[model samples]
Target: MNHLGSHKLNNVLGQILLAKRMGKTRVIAETGAGQHGVATAASAAKFGMKTYALFSENDQVAPVYSISAGLAYPGVGPEHAFFKDSGRVEYVAATDDEAVDALLLLTRKEGILPAIESSHAIAEAVKRAPQLSKDNIIIVNVSGRGDKDVAAIADYLEKRNTKNQE
Candidate 1:
């Protein structure tokens, strides 16, 4: 029921169907924690599109526990590599701190607890928002609920507080 959860599926379905209509058999995507990857794979499978996901090699960061349990990976889907070479999709990286900050900001402002993966997109948007004109429209996909991340976030904040006090 998260805001951007269905958007991912829709986007991937659109891409896969478009490529299929264009006679393309393969689809690829880049994901930080495999959320989009899983979605893309499912959609591609539905459309008979061969799917590949590209994942980051090093997901170790401040939220290592969440990353490891949720989306950390050493390799991406094979098709993602091919797409990267063909310029079909762009890859970007977000730091752990950026994600954490974005998560906090969105929670405080929008009252939404975004998944860590989705927080990366929010961080990117927050970075780009100030550079754009006031009338510019931006859409960010909030992929999932952050309920699962509550305990981890609490631990991280507690540690941060301890460090600040010391």
Candidate 2:
């Protein structure tokens, strides 16, 4: 796959198109940083699958990008948009914790793991989801690893401590 900034979404779109040719009817995924969300929605649209995405609170991109891309697909609609756009399928949760609760409910009702962008959140969400004995199926986008997040976390914590002491 091409790096985040590259237009490597073509690879994903190819896969979705192939799946559609093979008779697959739906596609689902999760997003964190918005890159994967945009890509997945585009792919689902390409394949004409009923696409659904689940995004985390940390997502920094507009959901409309993903939603519109999905809606542009033959069978998909804004309702399945996970990131942005206004429709029944798109659901915005207050936090990752809340998204997890919704994912758990979805797993119970749908028997599938909803897509999410964070690898860290996926396992926990899957475990919390009903009937998910194993969390291996949850695909985490892993946009940035712990090494990348450490400096940011430390900075935030230090600022938080300073604010608390003030």
Candidate 3:
């Protein structure tokens, strides 16, 4: 099978070997650069599994609880910070409610359950969609899939509804 170019061994192997030799098992990377923790994920994936689970049941990483193990982090890289500093980009934060709603909308309307991470972008897109002209386009970059998040989504909605009813 062909490998993804992003999974280029050079980005990870040497570092992984060194981590292993040191008996260390965790790695952290940039967060919020994509406004979706993708910067963190790119580095995490490069180093391989660091979650509580030993083996992933599918292609993507296993489901994680909120505060999202690898994604809910602080700070941005210099390049991302520079863009923000220069006024080239406007970073937005989407709440879990917005993201979960967006995820359900995509699942029911478009038959796509995007990753919890990518849902942040979709949530922002939904908020901006009505404000834009009909000709305007909003493209959400879905960097990951949501197969692992189905259960998590269900749990989140259940807890939210229950909490709201209280």
Candidate 4:
């Protein structure tokens, strides 16, 4: 409903919360640049569907730089493109090192080990914070737990350090 908040809407849409009503086993979708395919796959898995595109595990995969599974797609979808064209959104990027550094900073200061996907937002907020007035607020979605990424991040850092020493 129009009066429902975003959190409520998410709960209603989440298959776990409304399984009887919203659970679906099949999806028909068209994708370009792979974003819709990834989302469709994710949705299918969440709805207890047995399969997703290509991958046996229905796992979302991405290139090394974007180790965040959900965000591993090649580009934003049509709606996002429309938003960009309309100047409703300003897209920016963060390097793997920047995201890693931001992740560490947040963990050390706030005791929250945000997901690697979220670390990019943290990096962006950090970049823009100095330019904005002190009263402004920036909200970064820490979408998932960081524990799973700890080993990967550690290996990445170790490799980077070893390379720097060479």
Candidate 2, pairs of clashing residues: 29-115, 30-115, 30-116, 31-117, 32-117, 63-83, 63-84, 64-84, 79-89
Whole-model Cα lDDT of every candidate shown, in order: 0.72, 0.48, 0.62, 0.63
- Where does candidate 1 stray beyond 4 Å? 1-68
Report the Cα lDDT for residue 22, model 1. Answer: 69
Q: Identify the candidate with maximal lDDT.
A: 1
Residue by residue across 99-148, what tens digits does model 3's lDDT show? 88888898899998789899888999999999999999888898879988
Quote model 2's TM-score.
Answer: 0.32
CA shift of 84, model 4, Å: 0.7
**Cα deviation in Å at residue 4, candidate 4?**
42
Could you give candidate 2's per-residue lDDT for residues 1-166 as a string of tens digits?
5444636376557657665775666665554345655776766765567766665455554434221121222222222432233343333223433433444455577565544324225445455556665544555353433444335445555775798799
Kindly report which residue pairs in candidate 3 clash with one another. none
| Worst lDDT 10-window in candidate 1 | 59-68
Candidate 1 to truth, TM: 0.57
The list of candidate 4 runs beyond 4 A from truth reads 1-65
lDDT comparing candidate 1 with the true structure: 0.72
Model 3: lDDT equals 0.62
Model 2 ranges with Cα > 4 A deviation: 1-6, 57-166
- By lDDT: ranked, best first: 1, 4, 3, 2
How does residue 161 of candidate 1 score in lDDT? 84
Tell me model 4's lDDT, rounded to 2 decimals: 0.63
Count of clashing pairs, candidate 4 = 0
lDDT of 2 at 91: 39
